[model samples]
Target: MKLLIIEDEKDLSDSIRQYLALEQYTCEVAYEFESALDKICLNEYACIILDITLPNGSGLEILKELKRQGKEDGVLIVSARNSPDDKIVGLNLGADDYLSKPFHLPELGARVAAIIRRKSFSGQNQIVIDHLTLDIRDKTLKNNEEAVPLTRKEYELLLYFVSNKNRVVTKEAIVTHLWGDDVDMADNYDFIYSHIKNLRRKLAEAGCPEYIKAVYGMGYKFSIPS
Candidate 1:
């Protein structure tokens, strides 16, 4: 999954990123309001970890912008403030969950997973599509009860495909979703084509139907055969 961490505390944000990275999530961080606003407005994420306090402005305003844009990215508000009103206001402003600071990292991870699951996977930890089964918690996929080992990027690619099944997704969109701002360093999309090819080969070797389809010059689409 992809996540945006909008926290002012550098140490805390780094810690969160490292911890979540071990769980196989690609993370990007913004330490202030303007940058945070820029990211949220420009890209999509599975969940956003937002702090109510920021260097330039209140994070509540960011929440307002998300609500105004009708963005469906799951949000978990974290603040040192324990006030029920703050929590209430955040929840009312479209945040999916509230976390008081001085919280355990595991708990935060759990909450992030919960928000992603509730929003994207219909609150299920497992995604079953045809003969393929994906275990969200462990980041594993199975074909006909046999384990299908995938590289981290490949697994993420599959999940992204499954999430947007039947819709054509541009290579640019895929790059942004998978690589975040790091795409600026990439010279071309050869790596994306490589990942797609390998993923297709693995699924085919496992006796699964081909789901990912190239849409000529446009992009790629993932769809079950009817």
Candidate 2:
């Protein structure tokens, strides 16, 4: 999953990114308001960790923009403001959860996971699609009763596909989702093609039907065979 951390504190943002990266999440950061707004408008994330106070804007305004745009990305407010009113207002503005600052990273992680589960997967830890079962917490996949070994990137790619199943996802989108800002270092999308090829071969060897389809010039789609 991808996460956006809208925080002015560089140390905190780096810590959050490192911790979440261990959980196999692609993390991006916006240190101020305008960049945060631009990122929110341009891309979608599984969850956003937002601080109520920002460099030039209120995180509440970001919440308002999300609601105004009808974007359903899960949001978790992580701020030093622990007052009941702040919590109430954030929730009312469509935040999925709120975590007061000076919190344990584990708790924040759990809260983020919970919000993503509720918003994206209907609060389910295991997503069952046809013959495949994805254990979200363990980051494992099973084909029927057998376990399918997957690299971290492969698992993330598969989860991405499953989350946007049946929708055409462009290679650019895939690159961004997988590599985030670091994608600028790449010259081509051959890495994406390699990952997709490996994922297809792994799934097929695990006795799964072809779920990923090339859409020619468009991109790729993950749809079960009818």
Candidate 3:
């Protein structure tokens, strides 16, 4: 999963990033309001950790803009302010959850995981999609009762496809999600094609049906046959 931390407190943001990175999540930061807004406009994240206070502006404006733009990224508001009015306003504005300052990092990570689970995996840890079973916590994939060995890229690719099943996902989006904010540093799209091909081959060998569909001029979709 990819998370954007919109926090002005450099120390707190750094700690959150370091902690979450160990859990296999790509973390990005925007310490100020404008940078936060720019990141929101540019990329899609599994979750956004937003702070109510910013040096230049209020973070509630960021929530409003996300709602106005109709982006459905799960938001977890974290701030030093403990005002009930702020919590009420943020929740009313569509923030998924809120945490006060000096919160435990483990608890924060759990909240982020829960939000991602609801948004991406239908509120379930083990994703049972037709013939495949993926345990999000264990990061394991099984075809029927047999284990399927997949490279890290291939596994992430499968998760991406399954999460957005039936929706066309562009190659560019895939690169961004898998490689995080430094996608511009990626050389080419060949790696994506290679990962997809390898994932498909492994699934086929494991006796799973082909669920990925190419969209001709568009991108690719993961959908069970109707």
In order of appearance, the predictions have TM-scores of 0.97, 0.97, 0.94
Scored by CA lDDT, what does every candidate get?
0.94, 0.93, 0.89
RMSD of 2: 1.1
Which candidate do you rate higher for TM-score, 2 or 3? Answer: 2
* Candidate 1 Cα outliers beyond 4 Å, as residue runs: none
Better of 2 and 3 by lDDT: 2
Tens digits of lDDT, candidate 1, 1-226:
7899999999999999999999888899999999999999999999999999999998999999999999999999999999999999999999999999999999999999999999999999999888889999989999868899999999999999988889999999998999886888899999999999999999988887878999999999999765
| Candidate 2 pairs with clashing backbones | none
Question: Residue-wise lDDT of candidate 3 within 1-226, one digit each (tens)?
Answer: 6789999999999999999988878788999999999999998899999999998998999999999999999999998999999999999998999999989999999999999999888899998877889988777899887889987777778888988888999988888888887777878888888889998899889887878878888889998765
CA RMSD of each candidate after superposition: 1.0, 1.1, 1.4
Tens-place lDDT per residue, model 2, 1-226, is 8899999999999999999999889999999999999999999999999999999899999999999999999999999997999999999999999899899999999999999888878899999878889999999999887899999999999999988888999999998988887989999999999999999999989777889999999999999655
State, as a TM-score between 0 and 1, how close model 3 is to the true structure: 0.94
Backbone clashes in model 3, listed as residue pairs? none
